[model samples]
Target: GAGVSQSPRYKVAKRGQDVALRCDPISGHVSLFWYQQALGQGPEFLTYFQNEAQLDKSGLPSDRFFAERPEGSVSTLKIQRTQQEDSAVYLCASSVLRVNTEAFFGQGTRLTVV
Candidate 1:
Protein backbone atom coordinates (compact mmCIF):
# COMPACT_ATOMS: atom_id res chain seq x y z
CA GLY A 1 0.00 0.00 0.00
CA ALA A 2 1.08 3.57 -0.59
CA GLY A 3 0.33 4.59 2.95
CA VAL A 4 0.57 2.83 6.28
CA SER A 5 -1.63 -0.26 6.44
CA GLN A 6 -2.90 -1.99 9.56
CA SER A 7 -4.41 -5.42 9.62
CA PRO A 8 -7.59 -6.64 11.32
CA ARG A 9 -9.07 -3.20 11.60
CA TYR A 10 -11.19 -4.40 14.49
CA LYS A 11 -10.48 -6.95 17.16
CA VAL A 12 -12.37 -8.46 20.06
CA ALA A 13 -10.50 -10.37 22.68
CA LYS A 14 -11.43 -12.10 25.87
CA ARG A 15 -9.77 -10.89 29.02
CA GLY A 16 -6.32 -12.42 29.43
CA GLN A 17 -6.03 -13.14 25.73
CA ASP A 18 -2.97 -12.05 23.82
CA VAL A 19 -3.13 -10.05 20.63
CA ALA A 20 -0.76 -8.92 17.96
CA LEU A 21 -1.46 -5.97 15.70
CA ARG A 22 0.45 -5.40 12.51
CA CYS A 23 1.53 -2.23 10.78
CA ASP A 24 3.07 -1.80 7.38
CA PRO A 25 4.55 1.62 6.89
CA ILE A 26 5.13 3.41 3.64
CA SER A 27 8.10 2.43 1.61
CA GLY A 28 11.41 3.91 2.77
CA HIS A 29 9.99 5.81 5.70
CA VAL A 30 12.65 6.06 8.38
CA SER A 31 10.60 6.95 11.43
CA LEU A 32 7.79 4.79 12.76
CA PHE A 33 5.66 5.37 15.82
CA TRP A 34 3.01 3.61 17.85
CA TYR A 35 0.26 5.42 19.68
CA GLN A 36 -2.59 4.32 21.90
CA GLN A 37 -5.81 6.30 21.72
CA ALA A 38 -8.41 5.72 24.32
CA LEU A 39 -11.96 6.85 23.73
CA GLY A 40 -12.46 10.61 23.84
CA GLN A 41 -8.75 11.22 24.03
CA GLY A 42 -6.02 11.98 21.56
CA PRO A 43 -3.48 9.39 20.64
CA GLU A 44 -0.67 9.01 23.14
CA PHE A 45 2.80 8.08 22.04
CA LEU A 46 3.77 4.54 22.93
CA THR A 47 7.04 4.11 21.15
CA TYR A 48 9.23 5.38 18.32
CA PHE A 49 11.56 3.56 16.01
CA GLN A 50 14.09 5.12 13.69
CA ASN A 51 14.98 2.60 11.08
CA GLU A 52 15.43 -0.73 12.85
CA ALA A 53 16.52 0.79 16.14
CA GLN A 54 13.98 1.58 18.85
CA LEU A 55 15.12 5.01 19.98
CA ASP A 56 12.36 5.65 22.52
CA LYS A 57 9.89 3.52 24.42
CA SER A 58 9.36 5.52 27.56
CA GLY A 59 5.74 6.10 26.72
CA LEU A 60 4.82 2.45 26.81
CA PRO A 61 2.45 1.84 29.68
CA SER A 62 3.86 -1.45 30.87
CA ASP A 63 6.15 -4.30 30.01
CA ARG A 64 3.12 -6.23 28.85
CA PHE A 65 2.96 -3.96 25.83
CA PHE A 66 5.62 -4.58 23.22
CA ALA A 67 6.39 -3.03 19.83
CA GLU A 68 9.05 -3.76 17.30
CA ARG A 69 10.14 -2.82 13.82
CA PRO A 70 12.51 -5.60 13.04
CA GLU A 71 13.43 -4.81 9.42
CA GLY A 72 12.27 -1.19 9.81
CA SER A 73 9.54 -1.54 7.21
CA VAL A 74 6.95 -3.60 9.03
CA SER A 75 6.11 -3.25 12.70
CA THR A 76 3.98 -5.03 15.24
CA LEU A 77 2.47 -4.16 18.60
CA LYS A 78 1.73 -6.99 20.95
CA ILE A 79 -0.37 -6.88 24.06
CA GLN A 80 -0.04 -9.75 26.48
CA ARG A 81 -2.55 -10.81 29.10
CA THR A 82 -5.02 -8.33 27.75
CA GLN A 83 -6.98 -6.41 30.30
CA GLN A 84 -10.01 -4.19 29.94
CA GLU A 85 -7.93 -1.08 30.40
CA ASP A 86 -5.72 -2.10 27.52
CA SER A 87 -8.46 -1.62 25.01
CA ALA A 88 -7.91 1.25 22.62
CA VAL A 89 -7.31 2.25 19.04
CA TYR A 90 -3.72 1.41 18.28
CA LEU A 91 -2.35 3.84 15.74
CA CYS A 92 0.67 3.46 13.53
CA ALA A 93 2.40 6.36 11.88
CA SER A 94 5.44 6.84 9.72
CA SER A 95 7.49 9.74 8.48
CA VAL A 96 10.49 10.29 6.31
CA LEU A 97 12.58 11.94 8.98
CA ARG A 98 13.08 11.40 12.68
CA VAL A 99 11.87 14.87 13.61
CA ASN A 100 10.09 17.94 12.20
CA THR A 101 8.20 15.89 9.64
CA GLU A 102 4.53 15.12 9.28
CA ALA A 103 3.61 11.52 9.98
CA PHE A 104 1.28 9.45 7.86
CA PHE A 105 -1.11 7.44 10.01
CA GLY A 106 -2.98 4.26 9.36
CA GLN A 107 -6.66 3.62 10.04
CA GLY A 108 -5.58 1.87 13.22
CA THR A 109 -6.69 -1.36 14.82
CA ARG A 110 -9.46 -0.93 17.30
CA LEU A 111 -9.11 -3.41 20.13
CA THR A 112 -11.92 -4.26 22.50
CA VAL A 113 -11.22 -6.46 25.46
CA VAL A 114 -14.04 -7.99 27.39
Candidate 2:
Protein backbone atom coordinates (compact mmCIF):
# COMPACT_ATOMS: atom_id res chain seq x y z
CA GLY A 1 0.00 0.00 0.00
CA ALA A 2 1.16 3.53 -0.79
CA GLY A 3 -0.14 4.72 2.52
CA VAL A 4 -1.15 3.26 5.84
CA SER A 5 -3.69 0.44 5.83
CA GLN A 6 -5.90 -0.70 8.70
CA SER A 7 -8.05 -3.78 8.87
CA PRO A 8 -11.52 -4.64 10.07
CA ARG A 9 -12.85 -1.14 9.41
CA TYR A 10 -15.53 -1.76 11.98
CA LYS A 11 -15.71 -4.07 15.00
CA VAL A 12 -18.12 -4.74 17.79
CA ALA A 13 -16.97 -6.15 21.12
CA LYS A 14 -18.81 -7.09 24.22
CA ARG A 15 -17.75 -5.36 27.37
CA GLY A 16 -14.76 -7.11 28.99
CA GLN A 17 -13.69 -8.72 25.72
CA ASP A 18 -10.38 -7.95 24.13
CA VAL A 19 -9.74 -6.56 20.65
CA ALA A 20 -6.80 -6.37 18.33
CA LEU A 21 -6.28 -3.85 15.55
CA ARG A 22 -3.79 -4.17 12.75
CA CYS A 23 -1.89 -1.63 10.70
CA ASP A 24 0.34 -1.92 7.66
CA PRO A 25 2.50 1.06 6.89
CA ILE A 26 4.04 2.16 3.65
CA SER A 27 7.11 0.28 2.68
CA GLY A 28 10.33 1.82 3.99
CA HIS A 29 8.48 4.33 6.07
CA VAL A 30 10.66 5.00 9.12
CA SER A 31 8.01 6.39 11.36
CA LEU A 32 4.69 4.93 12.43
CA PHE A 33 2.14 6.13 14.91
CA TRP A 34 -1.09 4.98 16.49
CA TYR A 35 -3.87 7.32 17.53
CA GLN A 36 -7.23 7.02 19.21
CA GLN A 37 -10.18 9.22 18.38
CA ALA A 38 -13.34 9.51 20.36
CA LEU A 39 -16.61 10.68 18.90
CA GLY A 40 -16.38 14.28 17.70
CA GLN A 41 -12.80 14.53 18.92
CA GLY A 42 -9.48 14.79 17.25
CA PRO A 43 -7.07 11.86 17.20
CA GLU A 44 -4.73 11.50 20.18
CA PHE A 45 -1.34 9.93 19.85
CA LEU A 46 -1.07 6.54 21.47
CA THR A 47 2.30 5.24 20.45
CA TYR A 48 5.18 5.74 18.02
CA PHE A 49 7.78 3.56 16.43
CA GLN A 50 11.02 4.19 14.65
CA ASN A 51 11.64 1.09 12.66
CA GLU A 52 11.22 -1.95 14.93
CA ALA A 53 11.87 0.00 18.10
CA GLN A 54 8.94 1.48 19.96
CA LEU A 55 10.05 5.01 20.71
CA ASP A 56 7.22 6.04 22.92
CA LYS A 57 4.06 4.57 24.36
CA SER A 58 3.22 7.09 27.05
CA GLY A 59 -0.13 7.93 25.53
CA LEU A 60 -1.57 4.48 26.07
CA PRO A 61 -4.38 4.65 28.62
CA SER A 62 -3.47 1.54 30.59
CA ASP A 63 -1.11 -1.36 30.83
CA ARG A 64 -3.77 -3.44 29.14
CA PHE A 65 -3.27 -1.46 25.96
CA PHE A 66 -0.36 -2.61 23.84
CA ALA A 67 1.21 -1.76 20.48
CA GLU A 68 4.05 -3.19 18.51
CA ARG A 69 5.92 -2.87 15.25
CA PRO A 70 7.90 -6.07 15.29
CA GLU A 71 9.46 -5.93 11.84
CA GLY A 72 9.10 -2.15 11.41
CA SER A 73 6.45 -2.44 8.71
CA VAL A 74 3.41 -3.91 10.37
CA SER A 75 1.95 -2.77 13.68
CA THR A 76 -0.72 -4.04 16.00
CA LEU A 77 -2.72 -2.55 18.85
CA LYS A 78 -4.35 -4.70 21.47
CA ILE A 79 -6.85 -3.61 24.05
CA GLN A 80 -7.57 -5.88 26.97
CA ARG A 81 -10.77 -6.05 28.98
CA THR A 82 -12.68 -3.67 26.81
CA GLN A 83 -14.94 -1.12 28.34
CA GLN A 84 -17.55 1.23 26.94
CA GLU A 85 -15.10 4.08 27.36
CA ASP A 86 -12.63 2.24 25.19
CA SER A 87 -14.86 2.51 22.16
CA ALA A 88 -13.36 4.82 19.59
CA VAL A 89 -11.68 5.00 16.22
CA TYR A 90 -8.10 3.73 16.07
CA LEU A 91 -6.03 5.41 13.40
CA CYS A 92 -2.65 4.51 12.00
CA ALA A 93 -0.26 6.91 10.29
CA SER A 94 3.09 6.77 8.63
CA SER A 95 5.64 9.37 7.58
CA VAL A 96 9.15 9.65 6.37
CA LEU A 97 12.16 9.64 8.68
CA ARG A 98 12.65 13.38 8.81
CA VAL A 99 10.86 15.85 10.98
CA ASN A 100 8.06 18.06 9.66
CA THR A 101 7.05 15.49 7.08
CA GLU A 102 3.40 15.03 6.29
CA ALA A 103 1.75 11.85 7.55
CA PHE A 104 -0.56 9.56 5.63
CA PHE A 105 -3.46 8.02 7.54
CA GLY A 106 -5.44 4.85 7.09
CA GLN A 107 -9.22 4.68 7.08
CA GLY A 108 -9.08 3.61 10.70
CA THR A 109 -10.84 0.90 12.68
CA ARG A 110 -13.98 1.90 14.52
CA LEU A 111 -14.65 -0.21 17.59
CA THR A 112 -18.00 -0.17 19.28
CA VAL A 113 -18.13 -1.80 22.69
CA VAL A 114 -21.48 -3.01 23.90
Candidate 3:
Protein backbone atom coordinates (compact mmCIF):
# COMPACT_ATOMS: atom_id res chain seq x y z
CA GLY A 1 0.00 0.00 0.00
CA ALA A 2 2.96 2.30 -0.27
CA GLY A 3 2.03 4.89 -2.85
CA VAL A 4 1.03 8.46 -3.30
CA SER A 5 -1.66 9.21 -0.70
CA GLN A 6 -3.81 12.30 -0.39
CA SER A 7 -6.04 13.23 2.52
CA PRO A 8 -9.42 14.92 2.69
CA ARG A 9 -10.69 13.06 -0.34
CA TYR A 10 -13.53 15.52 -0.52
CA LYS A 11 -13.83 18.98 0.93
CA VAL A 12 -16.53 21.63 1.02
CA ALA A 13 -15.05 25.02 1.75
CA LYS A 14 -16.90 28.23 2.40
CA ARG A 15 -15.67 31.20 0.47
CA GLY A 16 -12.43 32.54 1.90
CA GLN A 17 -11.77 29.34 3.86
CA ASP A 18 -8.21 28.15 4.25
CA VAL A 19 -7.44 24.50 3.63
CA ALA A 20 -4.38 22.35 3.57
CA LEU A 21 -4.20 19.15 1.55
CA ARG A 22 -1.61 16.52 2.31
CA CYS A 23 0.29 14.10 0.14
CA ASP A 24 2.45 11.18 1.30
CA PRO A 25 4.49 9.86 -1.59
CA ILE A 26 6.12 6.50 -2.02
CA SER A 27 9.53 6.11 -0.45
CA GLY A 28 12.56 7.18 -2.49
CA HIS A 29 10.55 8.85 -5.23
CA VAL A 30 12.27 11.95 -6.52
CA SER A 31 9.74 13.72 -8.72
CA LEU A 32 6.55 14.93 -7.09
CA PHE A 33 3.87 16.96 -8.80
CA TRP A 34 0.62 18.70 -7.95
CA TYR A 35 -2.12 19.23 -10.49
CA GLN A 36 -5.54 20.79 -10.66
CA GLN A 37 -8.42 19.54 -12.73
CA ALA A 38 -11.69 21.24 -13.29
CA LEU A 39 -14.85 19.80 -14.76
CA GLY A 40 -14.47 18.87 -18.41
CA GLN A 41 -10.78 19.71 -18.45
CA GLY A 42 -7.53 17.84 -18.24
CA PRO A 43 -5.21 18.04 -15.26
CA GLU A 44 -3.23 21.26 -15.19
CA PHE A 45 0.21 21.15 -13.61
CA LEU A 46 0.44 23.23 -10.48
CA THR A 47 3.90 22.62 -9.14
CA TYR A 48 6.61 20.00 -8.81
CA PHE A 49 9.48 19.01 -6.57
CA GLN A 50 12.58 16.96 -7.07
CA ASN A 51 13.70 15.63 -3.74
CA GLU A 52 13.09 18.47 -1.29
CA ALA A 53 13.57 21.25 -3.75
CA GLN A 54 10.70 22.84 -5.63
CA LEU A 55 11.74 23.18 -9.22
CA ASP A 56 8.63 24.78 -10.71
CA LYS A 57 5.54 26.47 -9.39
CA SER A 58 4.51 28.72 -12.23
CA GLY A 59 1.28 26.85 -12.63
CA LEU A 60 -0.02 27.88 -9.25
CA PRO A 61 -3.10 30.00 -9.84
CA SER A 62 -2.30 32.70 -7.33
CA ASP A 63 -0.27 33.71 -4.33
CA ARG A 64 -2.89 32.03 -2.18
CA PHE A 65 -1.66 28.62 -3.25
CA PHE A 66 1.51 27.11 -1.85
CA ALA A 67 3.21 23.71 -1.79
CA GLU A 68 6.25 22.31 -0.03
CA ARG A 69 8.19 19.12 0.54
CA PRO A 70 10.52 20.03 3.36
CA GLU A 71 12.12 16.61 3.94
CA GLY A 72 11.58 15.13 0.46
CA SER A 73 8.96 12.57 1.48
CA VAL A 74 5.74 14.15 2.56
CA SER A 75 4.33 17.23 0.89
CA THR A 76 1.61 19.71 1.72
CA LEU A 77 -0.47 22.06 -0.44
CA LYS A 78 -2.10 25.03 1.16
CA ILE A 79 -4.88 27.11 -0.39
CA GLN A 80 -6.02 30.32 1.24
CA ARG A 81 -8.94 32.62 0.52
CA THR A 82 -10.78 29.94 -1.32
CA GLN A 83 -13.05 31.05 -4.15
CA GLN A 84 -15.68 29.27 -6.19
CA GLU A 85 -13.29 29.08 -9.10
CA ASP A 86 -10.84 27.20 -6.94
CA SER A 87 -13.18 24.24 -6.76
CA ALA A 88 -11.59 21.33 -8.50
CA VAL A 89 -9.70 18.12 -8.01
CA TYR A 90 -6.24 18.35 -6.53
CA LEU A 91 -4.01 15.50 -7.58
CA CYS A 92 -0.64 14.44 -6.24
CA ALA A 93 1.72 12.27 -8.21
CA SER A 94 5.23 10.90 -7.82
CA SER A 95 7.89 9.26 -9.93
CA VAL A 96 11.32 7.77 -9.38
CA LEU A 97 12.80 9.61 -12.34
CA ARG A 98 12.36 12.88 -14.20
CA VAL A 99 9.22 14.69 -15.34
CA ASN A 100 8.72 12.49 -18.38
CA THR A 101 9.05 9.30 -16.34
CA GLU A 102 6.18 7.08 -15.31
CA ALA A 103 4.42 8.42 -12.26
CA PHE A 104 1.95 7.19 -9.69
CA PHE A 105 -1.02 9.30 -8.80
CA GLY A 106 -3.16 9.61 -5.75
CA GLN A 107 -6.93 9.18 -5.83
CA GLY A 108 -7.12 12.96 -5.74
CA THR A 109 -8.81 15.42 -3.39
CA ARG A 110 -11.98 17.06 -4.67
CA LEU A 111 -12.43 20.56 -3.32
CA THR A 112 -15.67 22.50 -3.64
CA VAL A 113 -15.65 26.10 -2.63
CA VAL A 114 -19.09 27.57 -2.11
Candidate 4:
Protein backbone atom coordinates (compact mmCIF):
# COMPACT_ATOMS: atom_id res chain seq x y z
CA GLY A 1 0.00 0.00 0.00
CA ALA A 2 2.28 2.70 -1.21
CA GLY A 3 1.10 6.27 -0.59
CA VAL A 4 1.17 9.04 -3.14
CA SER A 5 4.56 10.71 -3.43
CA GLN A 6 5.86 13.68 -5.46
CA SER A 7 9.46 14.36 -6.36
CA PRO A 8 11.67 17.45 -6.17
CA ARG A 9 9.47 18.65 -3.36
CA TYR A 10 10.98 22.01 -4.21
CA LYS A 11 11.89 23.37 -7.64
CA VAL A 12 13.34 26.65 -8.86
CA ALA A 13 13.01 27.59 -12.50
CA LYS A 14 13.60 30.51 -14.78
CA ARG A 15 10.63 32.46 -16.10
CA GLY A 16 10.63 30.84 -19.51
CA GLN A 17 11.89 27.34 -18.94
CA ASP A 18 9.83 24.18 -18.85
CA VAL A 19 9.57 21.74 -16.00
CA ALA A 20 8.14 18.33 -15.31
CA LEU A 21 7.08 16.92 -11.97
CA ARG A 22 6.23 13.33 -11.12
CA CYS A 23 3.63 11.71 -8.94
CA ASP A 24 3.28 8.14 -7.70
CA PRO A 25 -0.16 7.19 -6.49
CA ILE A 26 -1.11 4.49 -4.10
CA SER A 27 -1.27 0.90 -5.29
CA GLY A 28 -4.54 -0.23 -6.90
CA HIS A 29 -6.30 3.11 -6.61
CA VAL A 30 -8.77 3.98 -9.34
CA SER A 31 -9.04 7.74 -9.16
CA LEU A 32 -6.30 10.35 -9.32
CA PHE A 33 -6.43 14.12 -9.17
CA TRP A 34 -3.98 16.98 -9.48
CA TYR A 35 -4.29 20.36 -7.85
CA GLN A 36 -2.43 23.66 -7.69
CA GLN A 37 -2.30 25.69 -4.54
CA ALA A 38 -0.92 29.18 -4.46
CA LEU A 39 0.54 30.63 -1.33
CA GLY A 40 -2.14 30.80 1.39
CA GLN A 41 -4.74 29.61 -1.06
CA GLY A 42 -6.83 26.48 -1.40
CA PRO A 43 -5.89 23.65 -3.67
CA GLU A 44 -7.58 24.11 -7.02
CA PHE A 45 -8.35 21.05 -9.07
CA LEU A 46 -6.16 20.85 -12.13
CA THR A 47 -7.20 17.50 -13.54
CA TYR A 48 -8.54 14.09 -12.66
CA PHE A 49 -8.30 10.59 -14.06
CA GLN A 50 -9.89 7.26 -13.49
CA ASN A 51 -7.28 4.78 -14.45
CA GLU A 52 -5.85 5.92 -17.79
CA ALA A 53 -8.88 7.96 -18.74
CA GLN A 54 -8.58 11.65 -17.96
CA LEU A 55 -12.03 12.55 -16.69
CA ASP A 56 -11.58 16.27 -16.05
CA LYS A 57 -9.05 19.00 -16.69
CA SER A 58 -10.99 22.20 -16.37
CA GLY A 59 -8.78 23.68 -13.74
CA LEU A 60 -5.55 23.71 -15.67
CA PRO A 61 -4.56 27.38 -15.76
CA SER A 62 -3.19 27.46 -19.26
CA ASP A 63 -2.33 25.50 -22.35
CA ARG A 64 1.25 25.30 -21.11
CA PHE A 65 0.28 22.74 -18.51
CA PHE A 66 -0.11 19.12 -19.47
CA ALA A 67 -0.61 15.94 -17.49
CA GLU A 68 -0.94 12.29 -18.23
CA ARG A 69 -1.70 8.97 -16.61
CA PRO A 70 -0.49 6.62 -19.30
CA GLU A 71 -0.53 3.23 -17.56
CA GLY A 72 -3.50 3.98 -15.35
CA SER A 73 -1.07 4.42 -12.52
CA VAL A 74 1.86 6.84 -12.36
CA SER A 75 1.29 10.40 -13.57
CA THR A 76 3.30 13.43 -14.58
CA LEU A 77 2.51 17.13 -14.77
CA LYS A 78 4.48 19.28 -17.11
CA ILE A 79 4.60 23.02 -17.43
CA GLN A 80 6.04 24.84 -20.39
CA ARG A 81 7.12 28.50 -20.44
CA THR A 82 7.18 28.84 -16.71
CA GLN A 83 6.06 32.18 -15.28
CA GLN A 84 6.47 33.95 -12.00
CA GLU A 85 2.73 33.73 -11.54
CA ASP A 86 2.92 29.98 -12.08
CA SER A 87 4.77 29.41 -8.85
CA ALA A 88 2.75 27.22 -6.54
CA VAL A 89 2.50 23.88 -4.83
CA TYR A 90 1.37 21.11 -7.13
CA LEU A 91 -0.43 18.36 -5.31
CA CYS A 92 -1.50 14.86 -6.31
CA ALA A 93 -4.13 12.75 -4.64
CA SER A 94 -5.79 9.39 -5.07
CA SER A 95 -8.65 7.44 -3.57
CA VAL A 96 -9.67 3.80 -3.33
CA LEU A 97 -13.42 4.39 -3.42
CA ARG A 98 -15.10 7.12 -5.47
CA VAL A 99 -17.72 8.34 -3.07
CA ASN A 100 -16.52 11.58 -1.52
CA THR A 101 -13.58 9.92 0.12
CA GLU A 102 -10.75 11.92 1.58
CA ALA A 103 -7.79 12.24 -0.73
CA PHE A 104 -4.36 11.72 0.76
CA PHE A 105 -1.94 14.46 -0.36
CA GLY A 106 1.82 14.50 -0.64
CA GLN A 107 3.86 17.30 0.87
CA GLY A 108 3.59 18.71 -2.66
CA THR A 109 5.89 19.78 -5.47
CA ARG A 110 6.67 23.39 -4.74
CA LEU A 111 7.60 25.27 -7.88
CA THR A 112 9.28 28.68 -7.74
CA VAL A 113 9.73 30.71 -10.86
CA VAL A 114 12.49 33.25 -10.67
Candidate 3: what lDDT?
A: 0.95
Residue range 1-114, candidate 4, lDDT tens digits: 467999989999999999999989998899999999999999999999899999899999999999999999899999999999999999999897556797877779999999
Candidate 2, residue 22: how far the Cα is off, in Å: 0.3
Ranking by lDDT: 1, 3, 2, 4
Model 1 clash pairs are none
Give a tens-digit lDDT track for model 3, residues 13-74.
99999999999998999999999999989999999999999999999999999999999999
How well does model 4 score by local distance difference test? 0.92
Clashes of each: 0, 0, 0, 0
Best candidate (score: TM-score): 1
What's each prediction's TM-score?
A: 0.98, 0.96, 0.97, 0.95
Q: Which pairs of residues collide in model 4?
A: none
List the candidate 2 regions with Cα displacement exceeding 4 Å: none
Model 1: per-residue Cα lDDT over 39-97, one tens digit each: 99999999999999999999999999999889989999999999999989999999999
lDDT of each: 0.95, 0.93, 0.95, 0.92
lDDT of 2 by residue, 1-114 (tens): 577899989999999999999999989889999999999999999999999999989999999899988988999999999999999999999988636998989999999999
TM-score of predicted model 3? Answer: 0.97
Q: Estimate the TM-score for candidate 4.
A: 0.95
Worst 10 residues of 3 by lDDT: 94-103
